[model samples]
Target chain A: MKKFSAVLLVLAFSAAALFADGLSLADQGVFSAGGIVIQNDGVFDPVNGQYSTYGQLLHADHANIFYQIPENSNGHSMVLLHGYGQSRMGWMGTPDGRDGWNDYFLRKGYSTYLVDQPRRGEAGQTSVASAISTEPQELAWFTQFRMGRWPLFNMNSQFPQDEESIDQFFRQMTPDTGNIDFDVIKDAMIEVFDKSGPGILVTHSQGGFPGWTTAAASDNVEAVIAIEPGGVPFPEDKLPEPVDAGYYSVGGIPMSDEDFDALIEKPIIIIYGDYIPEDSDLPAERFWRAGLEMAYEFEDLVNSMGGDCTVIYLPDIGIRGNSHFMFQEKNNMEIADVIYSWLDDRELC
Target chain B: MKKFSAVLLVLAFSAAALFADGLSLADQGVFSAGGIVIQNDGVFDPVNGQYSTYGQLLHADHANIFYQIPENSNGHSMVLLHGYGQSRMGWMGTPDGRDGWNDYFLRKGYSTYLVDQPRRGEAGQTSVASAISTEPQELAWFTQFRMGRWPLFNMNSQFPQDEESIDQFFRQMTPDTGNIDFDVIKDAMIEVFDKSGPGILVTHSQGGFPGWTTAAASDNVEAVIAIEPGGVPFPEDKLPEPVDAGYYSVGGIPMSDEDFDALIEKPIIIIYGDYIPEDSDLPAERFWRAGLEMAYEFEDLVNSMGGDCTVIYLPDIGIRGNSHFMFQEKNNMEIADVIYSWLDDRELC
Candidate 1:
């Protein structure tokens, strides 16, 4: 039987090699983050299946937004907001790494949108490269040595210091650059909901902060599925002290516990990594603990605000050795599943 | 407080719009399956920090094997296989969808290999356009006319004839076009293990079939993690005749029950999706029964093979709906946790 199986295996391989004419590993090489270019093609109209307008959102920093129409016209849409320094492609499925939450919801019948957040990806208004090169002696000392070794503490090294820096960095990063106004996302989402009806918002890592803010601002947002939302900026008392150099602390955004409580009123599901300590050497960890804490605090806040909330703490299976980019880890599908189930249970979809 | 909260919400949006550069929804568009391509410039080494001679594997059929230097120098190197018809992208994290399992393992200090399986994605010999146009008329007729209106089965119209057709159909419908060829996936996995030491084979959906087969064929595979595996290929006597196209049947493969028994000897954690019926239009009754039966058959098969098999029947989260692709659905992270917890409990990782 073993021998026969061996022959069968060889035969199968030969057959596969032959019959699989169009298939190749080269195909895998084609689907990269950089290769995925999003083209804006009109608003989604349930009444008609025609897409009229087409263009790409070249963020002021030149980042791209990769979005897709849902497979079903279930009158609901979803926006996938990726974390800091990640591109819109971060939401696309990965071959060997973590696939954020796109596939899970796609399977669940939601028109999904993925965007490379501001100051990240190709659209980055800040250039980590230039920042490292152009720092003052005091800042430059930290930029060169401290930045490389301890990225979490070196904020100036990570993002632009001011509006001028933002412009300089983005101009340096990509030639085709335009600022993606947040209103565009909001307006598009509103249009989708107006046509498809109310929808849900799913966000991961730093993306969660903006997602929550979006939901808080819009009655059209039915629910928010946040995977490790960073920094509960309400009820100042409960909020963590801002990490000196992290992006979460930028723009003098208050991290007060009171602010966190007042910012959200939508049903939220928070999924956190169980295994990894919140304070890893990775720069992203600076906000990881804040995200987890916000998830907890927000749960209470939402309930108090007459909204629903649920939290699922995942096992540290891949967390202990990973960074705050847990959404991009191996066990992410499990995380996706948990979120899917929660949405389903709540009928948020 | 409600009015005050509303005012705060408005301020939050205004602040975000003023401070953060947002993503433009108008410019974001979907890249249909196989429309995007990835370029591999062998820069990052999965093993040591330095780049090595190993280039990306572009299979003859256009599938891909993105080989990273093993992160774990002394630990096992494993293949991170995605489900059918999905590309390596399925492993990356998405905000609103399922999270990939790749990130979990990689972060856990495991050396990983990601491949797009053959006949799916860019590696797919059959293109969606071709699959749709060239489907056997009879099968197409059956699906279009007789099969229920459920989208899950509706996509099955493109499946080729045979026991593996269901697997093939699901793969065809998945968005990632570059799929991992079973033989290439196995070979790459073996190579990684050889370089990085022993490791387990982690697989989801159709990927499970190859993982099981690979472990059974070689002594190098230390363990197996099968998440909602399809195509179990059970014994003829154990299953009903005709067997329906979606369920396992004695088809192209010549492996006998005994052969299956002889092949697998490693510890395996089989995670089954607990699906619940919701809509009346869904074939909930049939699906639930079939899913359970298949799960039972798989548990029995692995245990009979003298392998340490742990079967986890996940809680019926009404949200997974009635779809067979539960692993790819939202809120399924609990399933991932179960797998990880089982591994940790057994000290397998």
Candidate 2:
């Protein structure tokens, strides 16, 4: 098992110059939030024989809508993606009944669109085996996200200790019914990308898995903010299964020169937080650190291919004591401010 | 999203009196290791419409052993189950190339048995789905384990900082092939328990899933230390598939009143660390926190059934700065000291 070649965790330096963000200062009429139909196509359920629609067609995935359509609406619209076993609700409210990122972003002035993956949350239905599973017994938020050591080892954790908050967070989660079809997710998201017009995409966790490829699949995508992404394109001719989700291409997937050209200027920022172990004893920590290495390698890959991608490690920048779910942390607003500033510096605002 | 009833993260208290432990300090000759064949059975291969042995029957789950005869051993033995994407190597060596728990436990005088699950590591072939998948991108360790915040927010962490150490940790990881076949894991582990005689079943991460059920399946198991368990019984008639991984019975599954009595005297301790969040903004953190709630409920269930299951939160006891892989951490020896004392308290060591 001691076989792989030695690797390093290097943060690449971006040489691109900053630009003024084109955020509209003028007051506008509509401030709205809604779900975009990522994949509405259907499959030939052999049981049903004839091809049906994705929802009626394949019996998978659903959505919602609400907004002030901000009178001060900036032309910039952002897409919000929840992690595995979750829906759009996560971006709207915290488990502790606090203001979630969705509202923050809305107030931040970006028109936000949230998504529920096929067969989960508002997404109607899908197969059971391929859906997301939090079935793992030992690894969860307490351990995986680094909120704390877990099982209430120390009640002094920064996580909201109130019972009501915990309950609220727990109640909003939704499980997957079948295997995760990354291709389907990409297709759906790309569709949303086209329907919603080119804007910035913000993805978290499992959503980050598809986020990379979806960014590459569409010309409409201006940039991507992958929050704690699960998989980045593994700098390979053929991107990995879950990353490509059986798709022919996505960001980082080796392709014809034309595809690579399309990826140019599609600014991508892979956001990470503190707690990625340098040499912790836990396999979970080690495994996570391994994933981050892939992302770093990806930054190198995308840059080598002439794509614009930057890696933002919050800890490196001075913000500390965050779990994986930093966006919803008590200090999430502060973290968001950091991200917002970066976007402003890059003129993505 | 805030549509749920209030809940709590409760740490159950036990009123049992303390007792002296009976240990054997005799010097034994010839320290050795071997694997226990948990399953040597045949199966019907539906694809071939014929009967075939499970990975050649004799090649079920594998385990290591010590002491010419496990039964003749000095009143102490241990069976170890590694977390997701990990094998027995986790117990023998840290990813950073340090002395791991395997050697420590061996030095502590307990005959240790290490297991590589069916189709995982050295256990040979099994279902493709149940194999390990490194697809999870951001949430596993950095935030989930609690070393610190994620996305490069902070670099100051307690993880080993040497490059060689970091390289060693990344090299040993194995990826999953198909969906995790939890039932297969449970069967293999239970068989090991019966074949090796009752001893302490120590589990980490995903292995904790089968760990709980294996304990329930075999009355031979003297005690269990489920470290930062991901899912406990959910207080349901039949445990959820991902939770129980589709086994007929386990915690959360109802049983005959007589069968419940079999759980008596099963001293179980669920250990956790300090990083689990109190008000994380990420759904990954909340989802994980929810899993802890289930474990808490399971403790309540086991206790009401007369089982001695105590949740040991490390931070609460003044042990902090630990990650999910406490067994392999730099201060693992300290954590082990705590587990060792607990085992001694129960006379299981």
Candidate 3:
């Protein structure tokens, strides 16, 4: 016990330094010489005048960090997008200090570009008065990802059990104090695609929109792997009498089909986890289950339009018990293997 | 967008059935009737002459539910305990509707008893003025479980993106307005053993203490599977020059060597995830890393005392990317495979 306390005492003092500024990417040892560069795709709002305290409104812009090819590069250049309450680090670490997807893929020879959406992470901040929605609370993850029952978790949950892991995961989750303009994020994504060159578009959760939006707008996009794409397009249970007036968009706000062409050449697969409609009475579970059904509707529409889209429910492929964060789950490597297998099938990787 | 809206409209109405008081065990088809019952093993406080609201403190009480075996059961019985803010359901179902640990074990022929510590879950409630801490907020899960950076998340994070999942996980999480009465939980566990006969003990997170506490208090526990047991004992970086008075414990309180004997006959294994110092340099991550070190110290101590205690780091075993919640992860079955393998090795199953 004395020994333990001593270690604690020592760490207590050392912690100030360790946490002072956090460990930046300089030590990540990920990029080769002349392979790393940081740029911004957004512009300062300046609407309120350059001198206004709120004038900078960092709202209209975003920042991108590009990790260039390493010595034995595989020529696989991909853009990595984070999910809600997360930044690039979400793609870098597993909370327990394991290799995040960015490094995993980078090691595999991929030139990875991680993006920070406008007003998120390093992009800058915004105000609730000028945004689309209020900063979200710590509630959405519980149900959408299927970690456990809402309000109450299934002790058998696949989510992490370590308190520090849990605490860390949440600690880095910077709340959106202001609303995010999806269009800005989409534009930033397009900018990333333009700067990074067409490659595989890897997106998780909310990044799904920006990924799809970017891919839809760029012919350069080679393939799209939408990991549980947010706001997926699903056919209505009943077709409207007339399909002319409204636009159906995967991204929020109605988008017309005429606005974008079906992704014919791009091999797209939307992957979701195993348990949906968990055998519980929670409405959240049911809603999620129903939402997932849309992936099928989307597949049919794409296929009808002569586009390439495949919807994969991990369970059907023998991968079960996956929560939304399967990418970072214990079997992440296995899942990556599965994804890589798909890439191989499509000859993308 | 029209199609999405149409589908949304239909689902909005049909969702009623989909979410109606989710289908539980009666329809779960996993167990037989007369198979489950609840019992308490501690006393309630009569602080106000047995009539005040605080009079029913029940600070020293814990509740346990016992699931009897079915005719086709494997004839194995086990006591299942949950982590912080969790109860029986934590072991029963995935938020997305997959089988929980309870069903998984029961199907494996192990009758299970899910515990609700005093003032937690179905165990009952307590007054904040009398407890150890405040009720948790909706934000805790964001980091604690490695779902993503708290408040904000990775657009690429696999944590559920939908609002329902988030809301559901929290709704069930009853904060500890008061402190957990570990002694009560331990007593309850002992009673479970008395009523159910000698069996294995499967504990997660906060339940770790009770599992250990109970084991220390009784010889009925045949084996122990401490899943990410919190407050694990750690080996001192260097033993103090003078081994003075003090104790090392997983929980905050100090424990003494004279208090318990080495779990000589009962084989025990503590399971931890892949990342400790998750790549992100968050203090929370460091804290978790420190905690995991304790597991090694614990294993060393138990083994030194002629006890069979092993520390299984999943990553070392080729299981990677797992957060704290391995038992409920996507590869849960695979993890279970490993655990079962150990059990088989010990001839416990």
Candidate 4:
């Protein structure tokens, strides 16, 4: 009882001190940079002073960055990249109204740059227009995300099961204003790093593919922490047979040896969550299982080439009950600590 | 020099104290509510356990609110609605990296809820599809927003003239994933008020029309502070002739007498920025001038009905050099102070 009381007092003091001397919302800075502005060729109407649609500047294809630097800073920034169908809101906080990785890392002294990638979320403007589909995707995504079959959740899932939480989770799924063009994504992401300075790339799911490419393209990405990256990249010489995971094939992208070598220059960590089976009837699990297999292969390839890589299977480390979205799970802080420890070991924190 | 030094010292101490005890970003809460979920009627594939496209849930037509409540909150929330083509980012800060109305109101002991209307910004999902136009609107909007003609800005404009600031400003414009349906927006705004409880609606340009209707529909909206409202609401019996303002019309919405009566129950203030000429060849200025004229007519209607309504031409009060987006200008804090004073007079702060 006394120990519990002491812990409470310590927590209270820490909260008070954090409120007093650390970063407040008012102290943070928010802005955007990167992406090319395409100027259309149109003349202005002399009589009305209105530029024709062709003459206007199209400010499309940029990453919108919302960042905060704490007073007691570690001097390193964590550039958070969201997954497919998600935005910077995913990294900001959880659907359950709890502190997300944004707050956790800030409290731990690292600045955060939550990004809304090109043609998605706040960066919805695009050079090429795509039809924004209104097809119902909530259930399809919920099942595909490996949370559980529709109307039933994984028994041990850490996702908040309240109605409101589910509503919020569904609401967070955004449509692409433009097609998911890899080249567009890469250019915008590279610009984000160019402007934000050197930072660690923290990517989730689909963002991992571009994250790898951006890291190879930009010297600013110091390291990468991929949370269930869709797939890693393989050098042309070492292409593995694509795994036929239903709905989509689990195949690593083929890359040039030069790009592979550039990627190997940075230390990397790949994290996979629970409920993924070695072999299962479920396509979601099958998909991740194949991706996990690629992760080990990539890890081995990197280490053989005098590069460092770590692949962590959460259950192996006694951290379980996490779906694909481990960062938003109930034990999110516990998972954040694991990444912190990895960063510490690499002397990057 | 001594007075200047004293002022600096006082400012320094205030910053320190604010850092110590006031609301930090971590202290704020963010979540979304009030969207209808459409369940598709399709069967799941028994073989793969995948739901058909028709079987998933479509979560659409909602307001996305990012809110902050300070430790010294005034107990009343101020709901901020952005202008056309913009999002909640407009109220959060300036493109030049200065505090916006969100920070100012938070500091003044009022909680703020920055909203992204249905089919806009954070709330991008919708029931109906709208073509996200890629037509360069930057220059056209620049002229239409009264920020001076493109390639040439007003000499005394408060807008940040730096290239980076202009880039940032252009990047802030977002596309509507769905069509701009007022009914959809009204429903979503009502949901926001329902969830956030009673509060004042602080609206800009395009948001003002919906703001008035929403206030009438939802009893929770205590008051309204409209900045350069595109148009006011007029009773059907007293409808003004629609003004022709070139590219579009500047006409107040026709409302039922009961709706108008309901609106008059709440204290309202209308603010118009500078650069609006009473007679101008510029369509943008002409649009606003006609709207300004309607504001007085609406004010007279409200006042005659024993309701409170104040319309202020910014230049009339010596607050000049403001374009349409006064909230994001260099003197944003000064404008915020004017708003605070008004709220104080109404016993709202």
What is candidate 4's CAPRI-style docking category based on DockQ? acceptable
Determine the iRMS, in angstroms, of model 1: 22.7
Can you rank all candidates by lDDT, best first?
4, 2, 3, 1
Write the residue-wise lDDT of candidate 3 on B116-198 in tens digits. Answer: 55444323322222322221222334355555454444333333445433332332343332367776567666766664567
Candidate 3 local distance difference test against the native: 0.51
Candidate 4 backbone collisions, by pair: A20-B20
User: Candidate 2 on A235-347: residue-level lDDT in tens?
Assistant: 34545443221111224334444554565458888888777767655444554566676677778877887777788777788876666777766778787787787678778
**RMSD in angstroms between candidate 1 and the native structure over all alpha carbons:** 20.4
A1-349, model 4: which lDDT tens digit per residue? Answer: 0001111211121111113322354255456655657776666542364756546678777777777666667777789999999888887667777777888887777778888888888788887899988777677788778888768788788988866677777888888998887766776677666656788899999999898998899898899999999899999989889989867798778989999999989999999999888888887778889999999999999999999999999999999888888888789989999999999998887
User: Candidate 3 at residue B140, lDDT?
Assistant: 36
With candidate 2 superimposed using the best TM-score fit, by how many Å does residue A107's alpha carbon deviate from the native?
1.6
lDDT of 4 by residue, B6-122 (tens): 112111211111133234542554555455677766664422656566566787777777776666767787899888988888887788777778878877777678888888877
| RMSD of candidates 1 onward, in order | 20.4, 23.7, 20.9, 8.6
Evaluated with DockQ, which candidate comes out highest? Answer: 4
The best candidate in terms of TM-score: 4
Ranking by DockQ: 4, 1, 3, 2
lDDT of each: 0.41, 0.52, 0.51, 0.79
Residue B338 shift from truth in candidate 2, angstroms = 68
Error of 2 at B207 (Å): 41
Each predicted model: what fraction of the native A–B Cα contacts (within 8 Å) does it retain?
A: 0.00, 0.00, 0.00, 0.47
